[model samples]
Target: MKIKKAFPPKIHNPETVNFNEPPAKLLERLYSSHMPRSYKKVVNGKEFFSKLDPNIAYQKCPKLKELLDKMLNLAKKSQSTAT
Candidate 1:
């Protein structure tokens, strides 16, 4: 006798992401994503940390705004699905 292979459950609506968390937390997670580069520089015996500005990122990467919008939508959707 051959045993059947088990498969993961299929998602009903793949377009809508369900993070199972609050909108604030979801937005924080999206912001923490590696969209901007962070750098550390030491000058005149002083260390400074610089991060890519959102405006610059938007200008440099056209898809940046689109991605951010998608994440924002996901965060909003998560708010409704949050446990």
Candidate 2:
């Protein structure tokens, strides 16, 4: 007589199944973008455009720079008040 070997069960997670897929840009309105349409960019703590290029969006996006500057200034102001 031979004994059967036991094995652990595999977990089922729908999200992990698609882990190889590209990251989504569901919230384009707030994201910064750099393109030929950079002039149309809006970052007055308001909105942005979708389908932005990665290099430009993360690096040389003029609108993004403005938004980040505004955010940094706000942060500094809040920190000073807290102190």
Model 2 TM-score relative to the real fold = 0.32
- What lDDT tens digits, residue by residue, belong to model 1 across residues 1-83? 01011212443433444678543344344434532532222431132114325675555554677898899999999998996
Question: TM-score for all predictions?
Answer: 0.33, 0.32
- Which candidate achieves the best lDDT against the true structure? 1
Over 1-83, each residue of candidate 2 has an lDDT whose tens digit, in order, gives 01001111432432233344422321222122422232222552133244435455535556666787799899999999999
Write down the worst ten-residue block by lDDT for model 1. 1-10
lDDT of 2 at 33: 40
- Model 1 TM-score? 0.33
